[model samples]
Target: MVNPRSSSSYRLRRSRFVVPPTIYRLALILLAFSVFLFLVSQRQIPVFDRGPSLPQKSSELEERLWDSASGYGYRPCVKPTHKYAGIQKSTGATDHMFSPIENPKSERSSATAKYFLCAFVLMSYTLYCRFSPIFNFLLASSHYICDMVAVARLMNATLIIPQLDKRSFWQDTSTFSDIFDESHFIKALENDVHIVSELPKEMESAPRVRKHFTSWSSASYYEGMSQMWKDYEVIHVPKSDSRLANNDLPVDIQRLRCRAMYYALRFSNPIESLGKKLVERLKSHGPYIALHLRYEKDMLAFTGCTYGLTDIEAGELKILRENTNHWKMKGINSTEQRLGGFCPLTPKEVGVFLHSMGYPSSTWIYIAAGDIYGGETYLSDLRSQFPNLVSKVHTESLATVEELKEFAKHATQTAAIDYIVSIESDVFIPSYTGNMARAVEGHRRFLGHRKTINPDRKGLVKLFDMLEKGELKEDTKFSSLVIDMHKHRQGAPRKRYGSLPGSKGRDRFRTEESFYENPFPECICPTDHH
Candidate 1:
């Protein structure tokens, strides 16, 4: 009913409210430019634009690891053809050097190189008891020692032999030599960092700096520590915790870690001989699956897993967890831990998983563990499926098991034997990916992509809940679900997955990356294949 001229005028005024085409285009362009600047500031755009290139190399080992055509991956099936039963008989220097120590010539050359480096830094593990309930020799000496060596090198400080913790639960006064090849360890790092036995007389009074307990520290954290060289004459790392940065280390420093752990840190001759013997015995049953059953009292107590335990056992583990001072997060609910799959797989669950995977009932499983919490009663379910379960504790020949008991007095020695057998086994499976499991998995990857079946814990727990509730049968449905769930986790040749989404700042390195635990895709390749 309005006048046409008035309506037309109103329409023209309304049209002016709409943004013009040129302004809209300009706004979008400004937004895009802001995003581009943000990406450039983050250093994300360049990383993507230039397709994945190998990290830079500084050592012979790094050179081998980064070789364009061959360093990245290998055929998993092609194992070393040579059959060597004993320590000496094992594949010699030409192959993947499994021998605890390199020869005297290599040691001497490394030592000579060490004599020309900077001032001395003496490191000692004096935090708690040396062999504390939480500390294992492999972790305390082998793993952290490598990190310390790398730290010493980065600081340009000559490393004195780190004093091993002697006063712990074991009570044995085991020195560095008692556990590791001390001479070889010192010599091995000669090229990378100078190592001395005792403090020089005049430099004994030099000021010492004890590092703070900053867990999974950053490279910047270490660089700041390196800056301390101007003020202090010597930097002494008094404790082992928070000793090394997670990533961003130089290629030589990382390679030095490899050298320190795999080659230099040799087990004592007797331990090596026994470990080799154990490997041979496990192999006597043909190919065996080494199961790292992390159901021991200490492990369960620490993790707060009580799925298969009796009321009494559960109460005890709960008390232990509460009492442990260093173990954070004490008020964990056992049911929640199990349902969320944060708990280690119970023996029964492990049995179900393996049976569902189509492993025959007669398959030999070597249980690498210290004394389990509930002992035979808890293991009965797994034993019912895999009756050929052998450990240092239980084996076919009771006499052989008895002989092993003598060496088993030293927990580290027994652990070494278990490690050697696990690494050389046909397959390795761990109920929980604890330190031992992580170390073994990494070593297996280094050997070649040896078959390691890591359980999809979170997914399996959901399926298990359905089965318990009678929603899903224990037949083909369960097997198919489990098999499909773990397809990607079967030790396949894949590049390392980066930090989890939303992980920022120090939190990015907070939870130790699996690749750092197992440096396969980075450090491992087939023999001469590269």
Candidate 2:
């Protein structure tokens, strides 16, 4: 005990300086906090190496901006490799399964398209026949009906059921029902506008105004007509074609036209079933080609194509062209027409074009048209090259004429078959840009811009003329020229504004575009959804 104080000091100094439990925990927590702060300060935190995290709001805005830069809205161009690539279906209940848009809630009430609108005025006599609508191709006639419905909607009038033309070549006495499913048509467009099987008894006696709606009429014209509805109970629309202005119509009307044509318009059950069967039959042999060879007798006579015709046949066509009073151009020069490529491509030319374009001989070519002007004799050349040419006519022959007697009764029905097959084909090539061709091309564009090789007829004609003069060979030079010429016209995606811009005031109606003929990037989208 001699040095107690010194001993205590020595002991205290020797002992380890242990930290308190609370202080130890606090120190560990502080160390972790420092590490976390370091990470937070850095430019990137490597969470799965997915790059810098975006604040949710800024990311969405950036994505939208990127999409806007691309031609269409938010959605990117559909990847070619995606499933259901290029398949287009109607947005109708009967055909919605085939719709390009993936709408899985078919059974759900919310899945259906809806509209809220009041019923408008009803005209007892809309004058379906007084105007004498043009007796055009099936598609053209269908477009007329679409415009008619659209016009009816615009006029705020109840549309009397339109009568199908009985004066056509096939001359089937069947009403609209024979070609299209009537129930489907009414149901499909129920929301857009009021359609009636027949004018109501009360409205039947209503004062009907026999008014002739002007062609390519704009919204103002229809508005004027609506005013007449007060004075006259019904405003009669004599002419159906170009009645509604293409561009001047409201967006709702334009979309209604599309809905009416593509969705509301459905082929009869029998025709639809047969069309699908024929398509499957053709595809069974692998990818086939659908060629709208506009070489029908009327076409040849109209265009004055004496290319591969005999002197008698040429003389006959000339006579037909001259005699036809409706044909504005009487003195059509066949040589000049062919040289300018205004005439339809002959069978031989089609063969050469397809061969040059790398389609093998084994390729299945389906001819989509009424009848070749010269029949088998003319199509022999194409047959010699492709040999696998098939058409609805060919397929129809498979069934006994007795079995298809009712089906064959109407040209419109047969045309329906041709349309379905052509639409379903992997490749569609049209020789001429007539109503049907343009309609199909536009439909294809609306679908997904499937490969519709609208052959550069004018350009090819020049090359062919040079070849005839021995200036070009049938070798790589010819193949290369054909390929290079058709680069743009191969159904590539493009933007389309209604007609050329520059229409002022009411004249703008004149520039109104055809919906089915040039839907372009507007009615179309890269994705399956609207």
Candidate 3:
């Protein structure tokens, strides 16, 4: 017979290796849960499948098609492609859809809902959050506002009207509605992106991610930024300037930027009325040139260019620069700055340049600028050359004068008035390449390539230096040199310049021409297309 002790040891070993029923039950539960999770994930994930064909109602198709292309994660709605479908009969629908003037309505009809539902189902897994960008820079720079709006679209987020930075250098407290027509901005851009006046009540106190996006960022950068929506309902951008790349953005995005800048961003009713009134008064006189002369105390202090200033004045600017907390670059070499063409031309230099430009003394010159740094001391020179120099302060209408006086301390409102006048002028000239200058130049391009003489500051500076040393004379030779130097610089249709030869990474974007400065091939189309 087998030994009893050995049999008992074998039974004990078998018992030690046996798995409990509870463990098997727990594993079955986990497997089932994992399978359920996989199903849920698949259902929620966005897929690139061709869904059912959209309905063929022309207006409905147009609305849905635009919405699909408007960062809504949907394949573009295709029109009937039969051999004799006569798509061209729509009369410039495809060609003009990208135009800033084109306002495509977002319909809420049943057909639109069906298409939207289809898109939503496909993109159910994608999360869209609300973006609230606080514009901490100059509100006068409309391009910054446009860039933020385009950023909102890129993020696929509902945009609450951006809050203006009242603490900026201007120190003027102006709300969004004070400078822009808020309702018009919202309503006009409804078809492209959702915009609300403020955050929802529930979301007002919710946790938000304050993001300072990388400067000159590409669209993919923002796509990656959207991942934060998983943890936060809102993304707050601290600063909005130069947040979008100048080039390499999608055509629709660039077109959206154009639409927002040109069509949607209308000035406030009071500002617009006053601005138009000033424009009318200006036009009544004759063709005038809007001269954006950026020679103010702040500009000088910020740039640290004390060229042409008296010793005492330069000292004052130096003190101001040192005292300003935000201005980082201190102790700038004024001589180097001037030689590098970073300084705004002095009033005398401007007068000399204009005189050389063939402009007669009788030509109307509207000065679009803040107070000259040295007041009449510096302005007398430019005035002596162009006797017809005028500003908003010189308007003849008492009512208009009183209205302007009401907006005296408000720099943005006043700047808006100047912008209107500048854009409508027969010719636009900027002595400095500031925000307003670039914006007006691009806008003039949009308005059928208007005459804008962007001064060659570097070349002109060299000439000015030569003239100062008595090596150059202010004769036809000088005039011809100036004219020829700017022959191709005037606002004309040309391809936007790309990055410099050796630029790499983000520097490439920084070096490229700003889209707002020249949105040529994207927003501006060829004549034959029309």
Candidate 4:
């Protein structure tokens, strides 16, 4: 209003000072590029560009496969190459040699993501007792410990090395480090969860909440549990078994379970060395069958299966069961237990089953068991059929005699040796589906689905009874029936079974197949997929 020319000059000056839209756009683009470069430099963002291409030659491909199989430059717990190629060929199991489809680099990143949040806040701690009194067997304890690792990861908390149970049935005072390679366990799971040898000095007196997580809890249950971090610096789990549900978990978490079980929980150096030595000795001979004959006095007493035992032996088993405070059901009917297929096969029945399966008398058999109920008295009939039957006590090499003697009294260590041999055997057979059998069968599946024969006890009991009553004979028809009955029982690549139909609530979890028994579609993938 004062002067048009002056106003126009002012406008022109203001326009010169103002930035153009194009320049603003260009500046924003540069700023975004700089931020992206910074993130790339810090590895906050993963580059997707194909860097070094994989070798295309057939020989190079073979080398690549071999390297993956052998787990070169990887952790010691990385799955080993299938060593029973001869057995695989004989059993037509060549199709199961594919490597796990997980991308290791991505897995590391995902595992890091799980705990990165805790790095920002006050670091929380998780301390758990690995061995519960109820499930204190070596393999059972191992499974529970693996579950504890998964729980620590789920809570985004650092896990203190778990305390083993010395007060359990075994009454062995083996510490965690005494049985497991503690350093290897820590290093292998470094990316997945923080594992310290013990609580930090500052956390020794920190306020902690002792929790006994409900068995077979879902992931959401653990997520709710992590909320405890706000009130307590440490969360101590009194028991660890079955804390994680069998199914309906994230793929990463399920895979983490596999990583913990298959790759982190390595046996101590002494145990592994002796176990491998025994395996080598057995492999030096022809192929052998590992028969996990669970006919020990303790098992018979616990199951109340005194069938085939003398009257005095039955009395002894009954008295032992009644005296055992932990074994709750003291008045179990032996006939009902046997009819329900809850009893382990007797040694004589094992002989008949194997002979019926067409295993010749000359076949090498390794009995993977502890002290039998009646020793050679009960085993005489089985030994008579399979003359090559042997056990760790009889198969010790000269160099390992003293070493074996050192582990003779420690049931856990001896069981570890049997576990190794059973997993490596040409065929694995369990007389009872106990913890060790489930663990071994699962491990064998992980190792390329090696042959594991799960005998149908319920089905076989009928045949056994008929033969005892002179109603049946061990003929070609019997062999065909035994073989045909087990056609689908062999370890095969399949998805884990879910809870039984109509199973609801927590009972459903109990009915579902054990994750340790079959980790498929999560840790395992078809060769066609990557």
Candidate No. with top TM-score: 4
Worst 10 residues of 2 by lDDT: 113-122
What ranking of all candidate models by TM-score puts the best one first?
4, 3, 2, 1
Task: Give the better candidate number (2 or 3) by TM-score.
Answer: 3
lDDT per model vs. reference: 0.63, 0.66, 0.70, 0.74
| Best prediction by lDDT | 4
After superposition, the stretches of candidate 1 with alpha carbons farther than 4 Å from their true spots are 1-137, 170-172, 197-204, 218-224, 396-402, 405-408, 512-516, 525-530
User: So what's the TM-score on candidate 4?
Assistant: 0.77
| Model 2, global lDDT | 0.66
Give one digit per residue, the lDDT tens place, for model 1 in 98-171.
12122244776455334212122222211111223244455545676677666665444556776665565665
TM-score of each: 0.72, 0.73, 0.74, 0.77
For candidate 2, what's the RMSD?
22.2
Kindly list the per-residue Cα lDDT of model 3 for residues 1-530, writing each as its tens digit.
Answer: 99999999999999899879999899999999999998887676432122112223545533321111222121111111121111011143211111111223445434433443343333321222222222212333467667777666655556777766666557777777888899999888766666777776766666677777888888888868757755776777665457788888777678778888888899999988987887777678766789989898888898899988899999999999999887789999998998898998888888888777666566678888888898889999989878778887754641356677778777777788788888888789898887788888888777766778888888998999999899988876777788678777777678789999999976788788878778887887654443
Worst 10 residues of 3 by lDDT: 80-89
| lDDT tens per residue, model 4, 326-357 | 78999989988998899999999999888776
* Cα distance off (Å), candidate 2, residue 353: 0.8
Cα lDDT of model 2 by residue, 369-401, tens digit: 877888889898889888888776665533345
